[model samples]
Target: MNRLTLVHLTFLSVGKPPAAVEFSPGLTVIYGASDTGKSYIEESVDYMLGASELKSIPEDEGYSSILLGLRVDDGRTLTLCRALGSDTIEVFSGDLRDVPTQPAEATLKYRHHPKSKSNISRYLLNVMGIDGRRILQNSRGDVVPLNFRDLARLAIVNDTRMADKRSPVLGSWMPQNETKEKSVFKLLLSGQEEPVRPTAPSNLQKQVGKGKIDLIDQLLDETRERLSVEANQTQLRDQLGRLQATLANATAAAGQVAAERSAVVRRRRELEAADADTQQRASEVQQLLSRFDLLRQQYESDLARLQMVGEAGTILGYFQTGTCVFCGAEPQHQHPGHRLGESTQLAAAVAAETRKTTELHHDLISMIEDLESQAASLHEDHARHTEQLEGNDQELQTLDQRLEPLNTDTAELLETRSRLERELALHAQIDQLEDLKASLSAAPPAPPVAKADGIPAADIADFEQVMSQTLEAWQVPGDNRVTYDPTTAELAVDGRPRKSRGRGMRSVIHAAFAVSLARRNQARGFIHPGFVVLDSPVLTYRRPEDNKEEDELLAYDVVKNFYSDLLDNSAGQVIVIENGTPPKSVRDRAAVYAFSVDGSTRQGFFPPLDSSW
Candidate 1:
């Protein structure tokens, strides 16, 4: 099996100095304090291979490109350079540590594409003699092109994943990819790839059945999500019934109150109209009385003037008999008959006018009395109307006050009913979805195909033996009887699952798994990446702050044992990233890089901003 080894990783920029780190072919240990870019080294290596993106850290600012050096099994050195935020990789023929000044031998895409071979994944897989491999992705015997990322996860374990509860064979924690991850593991174990199977002619009925199944699965997922957050259906229905009854009673009471309010409002409006009319009539009557009083005064003045005129006529006829006052003649020239006749006629006319004037004045007084009577009657009517209007207003106000609580109750009940109805609707929808899913599940399933599945039992037993030997060599504190469970893809020690152990134990077990897998591959001549980068593999051995229970379990000198075992027995390049220092003897044997924060030693993968290096 051909294996490509990592030579170095470098970060370059335009004006800023390059940050770089070289790796040993056998064992390289980078142990440092926190926040000194120890984990970043592992991340950059993975990114250079096929990871989607590189994490952005403040310390990585001003760096525009990353260079990864690789040495093939044939002693041919190559460098892969990729710009920041770009998806293309530039492949150089030689091990140029810094950014390449000349053009690259080949340019490849960062991502793996099945139809195209000009990608970094295919290029690296070809170099390792494992290109064009296929793995079963699902139980339906569906196969997908085996991607480099599948193998990268097995080789590159980060700090966060070092102590994961899941089995190390299952790289991603996603449950949906269990089959595919298991297939990848089986591939690493057996060195066998799933062959391509031909598709049968499509049947209309089968197509429809499959489509229905797919839709039902989607609906089931959605329904489950909804039901996860909803209350009990029976309880919701009961609450809805109660709300409906309460709303009915509230609505009836509100209707009665509304009717009573409407009646009072109508009466108030009628009273208002009548009051207005009465006021208008009273005003008219008062004006009539005033005019009538003025007419009565004129009538009295006329009567007095008429009486005075009659008296003056009588005086002129008696005292001025010598002269004819009527014609302005002397008494001797005037005719006696003319004077006496004129005086008598004048007195008669005055007496008649006086009688007429007196009668008119009495009539006028009677009219004035009638008008005053009418005015008084209108004033009384207006007062009565005003009182009635006030009474109606008070009644309307009382009706409104009575209706307030009823209206409030009705509104609240309606809102509750609306909420209950919405819940009931959701319940109905869920019920429908469940029924549909059940019906779809009742459909006939596709016939199963017989193909190689799971790691062979003999192969598993061999791997388990190797796992036990590795743990014993490291002197892990336990009676280690390692057994691999294919069903769960987990390893167990003395009938106890690895996940049930502490974080420290889990980390150690995870490291043992990776190291053992590599060694097994090398020993049996299986295909592998020939390198493993573990971040914080011995976490609990040094960092007791993670868990006190882990500290208690890992009380032995496991760190020294761990480094010593890897130095002596590791099959390929093993890069260990940790927090604290390893044993001095082990450190002396391995290529060790120490990082610090107080300018004591090497700062990190990226040099300090103030440093002249």
Candidate 2:
């Protein structure tokens, strides 16, 4: 097996100092604080190995080109140089650490092409003696030409991927990539590729299938045309649920408002009735007061007349035997039995009439007083009724104000629910039509391929043994009973799934998996890149807050043991990018680069800018 090892990586730009880092043939440790471009080194290496793009950072601003140095097992030192933002890599003959001054080497496209050997993927694979390989992409025996990226994903474990809950063999959680990823893993383990065998349906079957497919296509188009909404079925359902809840709330609120309005209206009616009755009573009291006043006035008038008569009789002196006061003649000339003798009787009658009229006047005054009191009471009642009515009117106005918006909200929610339901229905129809089309178009099932086609069960057991030994060597806190599940391509420790562990444990387990795979491949003489780059494999273990009892045990000396074990056992280059510092002894044994942010030591991969340079 031919393996390629990384030598160094360099960055160059005009009028700037070249930023570079060299790797050891054994273990290399890059450790430092965050934001110091430690992980950028890993990214740059992956970028040189045909990653889609290199992340842009502030430290990488002035750099215009990236250079990667690789030493083949056959003593050939090849340097790959790529310009910034360019999709092609320029390959040179020697281990050129600096920008090339001459240009007489092959240039290769970054992407892989099936018919072209000049691309970078094919070029690298050719160097590894694994070129022109094919692997099964699915159970149908459909094969795709092997690319270097399939191996690179396993070899280079970035910070974000190190703690991923997904299996290390899988690149992502995307369902479409599962079969291909599994096949790639099989290829790495067995060193044999699955041959391509194309399968086709019979003509008669194709004819029947085509007719059904055409009808399904038309139905699908119509269904899709009706699916005018932008949201998918799940989103539509979620929206409908939320809209229903909101509509229910709005309806309840509207009911409450209506109830409140009814109460206010009823109260207003009661207040109005009370106010009318009060007004009527007040009017009646006023009329009685007027009549009593008239009666009192008449009584006063009769009393005054009676008093005048008494005074007139007294002035005439008819009762005192005075001479002829009434007829302007002597009293002796008046007959004793004449009407003039009745003057005394007339005075007595006048006095008695005056007393009765005065009493009647007193009674009338009392009646007027009672009427005035009733009028005052009725006025108070009217005032209270008017105040209550005003209050009810204000409340009704407020409820009406609230009901307007509630009604509007309810209408909007209903409209939204209707729209969402329509979208959901359309989605279901499209799904059903697609399912029917699939059933009609599906070909006869291919002969069942052996589940363990490439990597056998014994190989999985061997791999699991390697992982258990690695964890045990690192003194990881577990029984170290490692098991590899081929179905999920995941490892379990002590009967617990790798994904069930905390982020810190997952990171450690993932690193152990990568290291174990590389070690196993090297031991078995399998085709591998001969080098692995791991970013932040021990980052979570450094944080005390994330530490558990198991993590605390892992943190004690796991970092030192991790570095020491790799240094002692790694057959090819193993680059570790982390934030936690290794032990002094391990640092002394391995090639260590430290990045600092406060100018204490080397600042970062990119050196400090000097105007003198």
Candidate 3:
């Protein structure tokens, strides 16, 4: 089987300054302090392999792009460059310097896409001598094209996962992915791919129908909670009809009351307008009467004064004095300036004033009488209008009293009608759900069977034996014999659960399990990517947990013997990332890189701050 191996991983700054590390074919160890880039090495390798996103770190500040060089077993070199936060990787035929402006081949998609030829997973899988392969995802026999990322968990183990208790075969913590994950692992172990068979259109239609049935079932359950009555569509419709008829009757009765109230209100408005006009007329009549009374008094006073003048003139005429009584002269003796004719002139003037005053007195009396009559008529009209308004107000109060009960009844009817309509709608929904359910039942697709027939029993036994031997070689205490539990997809050591052990023991066992699988693949001619990267595999030595004295010895023995075993067997390539110091025996055999924070040799994975991007 063709296999791929990492040659180098480079982080290029904007100026193309490089922070890179080279790897050998066999065991490679990167041991360093807490904040060093030991774990980042594992992450970068994954990112280059097609991880969705790169972890942002302070050490990554200067890096604008990542370049990974890979060498195939056939001696061909491939370099892939991906800019930060980008999903497209430029592929080159050979390793080159300074980010290439154009790739030699078409760009590869970072994530797998349906029906895409340029996805990185397909590219990498093709290079690994596997193509056109499909894995059974579910048992209605749905198969999906193999994806590299699903297999990456087995190839690369990160630090936090070192403490996880779930089976390493499980990709995510979600329950739904467990079956697919186990299936993929089994396929890798058995070296067989399920045949691709296209589903018929009828089968697809059945599946879609089933999905709709499920959705309608869920909707019916929700609608059931809101239904006021438990009844079928027929019964509910009958009840709706009755309620609607009742509502119509109630509406008509209420409308009649409303019309009557409206008529009463309109009549009240008309009476109010008439009363206003009558009041205005009464005001004008009162003003006219007041003026007429004043004129009548003036006319009477003038008439009285004129009558006195008339009497004085009559007396003067009866006396008939030819000359002024004081002068005592005859008519001939009266001078032009004398008052002999003054009395006659005064009588005449008085007579003319009296005649004019008498006429005015009669006219004023007549006008005053007419004004008094008009004022009386206005008073009568005002009284009549006031009575009419009072009657209208009483009628309005009666209408209001009648409408109050009608409004309450109508409100209750409307609320009942609305509730009945809602129930009717729910009935319609239930009917729809029933119809969908029946349709689905009539043309049901095969149910998805549980994925139980996992890896072959003989293959599992061989895997168990390999795991047991690997752990025994690592000097892990207790019965090192392991068994793979198909149900849990986890390993059982010494008849005890792997997760039941201490965290440190779990980490050690997890690493052994990973390395053993890779070794077994190479030995048994199984399909594998030919490389595994483990971060913090031997954490027991770093932390004094789970029997310190015993763990220290085991950790030392495992670290010392682990590398020797891999190198001695020419096992698949492995990268072990750890914080604990490496054993002298292992250090001598493995390519080692030690990192620190004090600006010593190999300060960190990043370039100097001033030289960074």
Candidate 4:
């Protein structure tokens, strides 16, 4: 940031307001004894420059406005004003000799209201191009400094917590919170802050930063007390529910089994009744077969006798059988012409007997056929009955197999129902246990707000740039290294950033931060409104003279280098409202624009010390 040279300003004015205070690019001081409107002037600048808050004035100072005669980077002259009530402020670009007034292209307002106190480090932020946390107050007078400062450690305010000093919490580094913000700031400036920070996970997030457990035993005790009864109940309940559902399925299956069993029993009884009919058919078929076999033997005998008679007739016809033609007398049964003798008669009788026997054989054959036909019909009926019996037996076997499982299933179903009921009971018990446990246990606590994105931490980019440039201003060794720790959120040198809690250490750190920023402005031009109107920084000195000399020297070098750097830098203006002398080098190089408290104007007005435009 460029060192400021105040040219003109008026807070409580009568005629037209001192609408402009053209600032110089070099050293500018608005020094005063107690309250010569020095702080008010700073507040005026802040009001015009978009401070979230501003000081309220009495009704006498209507529509507070500031006007300035300014020099451009191109060596041109212009007039600028900040009008509180006007729709737009006026701007003149040319020479003071022939000024032309026109409305400014843009109208900027303070981020804070025009009734709040401004912090010193905030001015530094504005100069380095940072927006310090502008706390908004509530009706109850509670301040919620811009929510961006969740972590207080990130806010480095005064000389008490300089960046160069070793931090106490971190023996070899700065704080983690600050470094994180710094990294973010750097990224934001570079347009890369959006990509950082972990993405939210898909799984249920385990509540972080909850349930206090200061000691290991306390944690164990809490877990044990909370989970013991609930765990057991939950398990039992789950088991019971499962068993009940299983049992329901089993009962349904068993009912189907019982229906099948009834069908099997009815079929078995029918098969037993058909057995007697099958036996009767078998006995009739056997008697007919026996008679047929005896008839077949008798038929064979008759056939043999018929054959013998036929042979005898043929012989008798050929031989004249009147007398004993082969000793044949009258045939035994014939008496004609030597008639058929006893032999012929006996042959006739034998033929008749044979015929009868042949008839009997045929009858036997007919009887056998009838018996066979009857047997076949009965066998068919028996076969049908046997088939029915086999079917019934098979069904019975199947039923027997299913019956056992069916009964078992029915029993299981009952058990399952009981189990389900038990499970429900257990579940209820578990729920009660959980409630009791929760009631007995303390509620989880919220985490402390982390200090990040505020002036101190957010200033990391400015802080680092300033410090690095400061060292460069001092021109330290080429190997002088620097790194920022994200975890501890501190800037580490040679790879370590320690948190400083000691008085000297903190002072040095703060001093380093201021010098670094001041030196950076001295070396490079970066316009930021966070830094401006740094009237005085609040300090907390822990010791009489701890690291005081080192801090002073660091301060001097930084201020001197900043002045030297401002010759070309145009980032923004820094108005250091100081009570002591500045370094010699700073005095020799830059123009001094001061606000003498005992001026003709009681409130002290702006005018160049050398009276040069």
Clashing pairs in 2: 324-331
Show where candidate 3 strays beyond 4 Å. 196-453, 540-554, 597-600, 610-613
Model 4 / residue 28 / CA error / Å: 2.0
* Candidate 1 lDDT score at position 132: 82
Winner of 3 and 4 under lDDT: 3
Worst 10 contiguous positions by lDDT, candidate 3: 540-549
TM-score of each: 0.59, 0.59, 0.58, 0.35
Residues 576-598, model 2: lDDT tens digits:
99776666787678889977622
1-613, model 1: which lDDT tens digit per residue?
5887999989998777888888999999987667778889999999999888999988899999999999988788999999888999999999897768898888999899878989999888888888889987766577888888888999999977889999998877777688788888888888888866643224775678668878877876775665532568788788878888888888888898899888888887887888788788888888887887788888888878877877777778777766577777886777657766788898888888878878888887888788788888878888898888788888878888988998898888888777767766767886787777677566445546524346788888888999898888888877778998877888898889989988988998999999999999988889789899999888633341332222334544787778888888866999999876766786678888977623336877788887664
lDDT, candidate 3, 1-613, per-residue tens:
6788888888887664688888778988887666667788899899988898887988788579888888888889989888888988878888755677664586888988648879888888888877667777765557787788877888899977876798887768987777678878888778877655454335677688768888877888998988877777688678778877887887888788789889988988887888788788878878887887888888788878877876775565456557655346786887764553665677678778878877887887888788788878878887887888888888888888887887887788778778877888877777878887887677544454646346788888988998898888877788898988887898779988878987878887788888888889888878778888989887633431222223343456776777677678666788888766666677678788867622237766776666644
Clash pairs detected, candidate 1:
322-331
Ranking by TM-score: 2, 1, 3, 4
Give lDDT tens digits, candidate 4, residues 1-613.
2223334443323333332333445445443344334455566654433334455544224435555444434344544454554433344443332223454533433233223324322332333333433331211122332322211122223222232354312222433333344433333223222222222322233332122222333544554554423336556576667766776677667767777777667666766666676668667687768877777876887788787876676467556544555345555634554433545665677678778878888888888888888888878888888888888888878877877976877787676566556545545655555555564354443233333323334445555555555445443333325444434445544443435333433343343444444444444443222233344321222122232223333355444544455444432455555333344455455444333322223233433223333
User: In order, what lDDT does every prediction score?
Assistant: 0.81, 0.82, 0.77, 0.46
- Model 4 accuracy (lDDT, Cα): 0.46
Q: Output the number of the lDDT-best candidate.
A: 2
Q: How many backbone clashes does candidate 2 have?
A: 1
